[model samples]
Target chain A: MVTEFTPWQSLGGGVLIGLAAVLLMALHGRILGATGILGGLMRFNDPADWRLRAALLAGMASGPLVLLGLTGQVPAVDIPISNLAIVLGGVIVGVGVSYGGGCTSGHGICGNARFSRRSMVATASFMVTAFATVYVTRHLIGG
Target chain B: MRLLTAFAIGLVFGVGIAISGMMNPAKVLNFFDLAGTWDPSLAFVMGGGLLVAIPGYRMVLGGPYPTFEPRFQLPDTRVIDRRLVLGSGVFGIGWGISGFCPGGALPALGTGKPEVFLFVTALIGGLLLARGIQSRGLRTKAST
Candidate 1:
């Protein structure tokens, strides 16, 4: 059966995400862009910088862990392929984030908010590519 | 203060993703698979994102110019030209095929799933290509 999300549940999620992003900005003056955070870690070595990146990445990873630990409600995942395909998929996504100048969060959230035209184009591109890829892989090519 | 705040926010963001199920790659993949068993949870996720963003937006706009630099530094582009179209097309293709968009991917990495690693690699490759094209003066004419 297809899982459905209620408006309130979705809104609750939004409020949390927004609050997190805004709180980060208000307190640290930083935008929560995953690519920039990860990219910064890759490029820089300042001790001070490492902490934020580590924490940001950790928080993201930990979210699911906490849920799995607490609720025992694992999200359903159904990739009908070997591990190789999944790994390849990850690499492609990483490269795309780099080439796109930001990930979905950076462009979709931060960029769109600032009325950035590039971000709009980038986000749209992201969605379209995502749609097309799924169609080709799952339906057309049957990967 | 800033560092602490950033950390706190990051934690909250992570929790939100987890609770909302966006942290699960399977959920995301399902959303992309319209033909198989289409999941509409992502639409809620997007809606939730907008709800948080729209208000936060006003706060930023109403405030004094940022003393610590703006959280959002708008890209300097104005036109809806070729570079924009091509870049977007490439990005969309990747997203549709993999079901690992940026926000969804970051949280997934926390799962330590091997797939996250591979998807990330491809995402970086795409970025490099864009950078190379820009450096070669094949610039997109859409700047703020």
Candidate 2:
């Protein structure tokens, strides 16, 4: 039988994500768009912006670690693809973020939070594509 | 008021993820696996997000326009243009193959898994390529 997700657990996760986004915005006056944070690191030469971007990245990277330390169990993950495929996949995502003007976090979370019409379209497009891709790859290509 | 409200809302959002098991990459990856075992946690996540957002959206719309920047910024375009279609296609392919969309990817890095690093590198490469294309497009328009 498939295990059901508890509503309380789901609510907690949402609360963390929402708080993190809000904290980022409240302190820096910037939205916690992962793509923007990553993009700023690549494009901006300004020291202040760079420092803040680095910190944001660092925080995200450390978040799971903190969770692990507290919970004593890392979340389970099973990816069938090889490491090389994973890297290539990341490259493609980077490209998409560039083209789309934001990553899922930026567009999906903060953008949606702000109710940007573009974000709505982008998020929908991304979700649809993701759904379609999964269907095709797993069903058609048998990957 | 805005800052406090934002924080409060965000807290709720985070709690939702934590509770839903969406914060757990294993749960997310399980959702992606179709052939062996399929988990429908993702559907639940989306359902939950929409459920909260719909009511929250109604509340926001009912309020007066803010003097400063509004808390939400809606997209301006009405059409499902080429960029939207193409970008989404690319994103989906990547997500399908990797099982790590941006939201999950960020949190996954916390595990200190080597795979996360690889995923992140490629994600950056994708972003850079997009920026280059955008800049080139801008330059071409300027020249024209």
Candidate 3:
């Protein structure tokens, strides 16, 4: 798939995300890992923890509205893979994050920023595999 | 107040993902495809995030405590165990296969696509399965 290179938009979005991460640390004193937050919700160790996660998730769910207000429409998301692939991918990612302790947000953004060796290693590990996976799928198998 | 701040932060994060087009799996996949139609925008996103966050973390963490919380709930483990590497590799394969990381997937839910819901459901199931395995391992360790 020929995706357009979005430097400016991506950079702007990155800044916003960075801001959010900082704010989460500043206020809640928590790391903003998307999968960790979701998994925490399922565990529901405490009402306060659940509430915090729920509020963040609810805000995430409502983000399209914010996009609508800003861009005059809810952005369209394209899923190029099949339903089966999506499910398989999701399950793998779920287990991976549970074992890895973070995904893109946790390790990629928050952990790396803090200069944690573990987060850096985790980021590099995933990135290399992701590159190899894409190479295999798009180039080799032609999926 | 904490909840409100968390919500606002989530909003910002979701908007960032949307604006950067990370919510689209195809775009993300293309980023990984170095040989074919590779989009280098994701690099900028990571760079831009680090540009701000590195300094921000330094400033905030310099303090004894955060504004609302008693202390930072940062990860305390220093050991980079097998679980971290192997699990990350597995997650990376899944991400490359689908182009939907947890961060992108969560915000994409706003689009109200059945596929997103499906992927998320499967992801949740995976998380549960992993947790079960970990707890079981712990139980065995305890028994031993």
Residue-pair clashes, model 3: 0
Predicted model with the maximum lDDT: 3
For candidate 3, list the clashing residue pairs, or say none: none
- Residue-wise lDDT of candidate 1 within A30-118, one digit each (tens)? 67788787777665568777877777877776666776787885544344455655545655555566656676677777667656778
Superposition error at A63 for model 3 (Å): 1.6
For each model, chain A TM-score? 0.83, 0.87, 0.96
Looking at model 2 chain A, report the run of 10 residues with the lowest lDDT sum. Answer: A1-10
Q: Give a tens-digit lDDT track for model 1, residues B71-143.
A: 5344455767665556556556656655566666776666666666666666566555555766665444554
Best-first order by lDDT: 3, 1, 2
**Model 2 residue A26 lDDT?**
41
Q: Rank order by DockQ, top first?
A: 3, 1, 2
Question: Using DockQ as the measure, which candidate wins?
Answer: 3
Judged by DockQ relative to the true structure, which candidate is superior, 1 or 3? 3
Candidates ranked by TM-score: 3, 1, 2
Residue-level lDDT tens digits of model 3 in A1-143: 68888899999989988888999998989998898889889975699999999999988777877988887988768888899899999999999988898999999999999999999999999999999998998888984
Q: For all the models shown, what interface RMSD does each have?
A: 3.2, 4.7, 0.8
Give each model's whole-structure lDDT: 0.65, 0.62, 0.90
User: What DockQ do the predictions score, one after another?
Assistant: 0.47, 0.34, 0.85
Worst 10 residues of 1 chain A by lDDT: A73-82
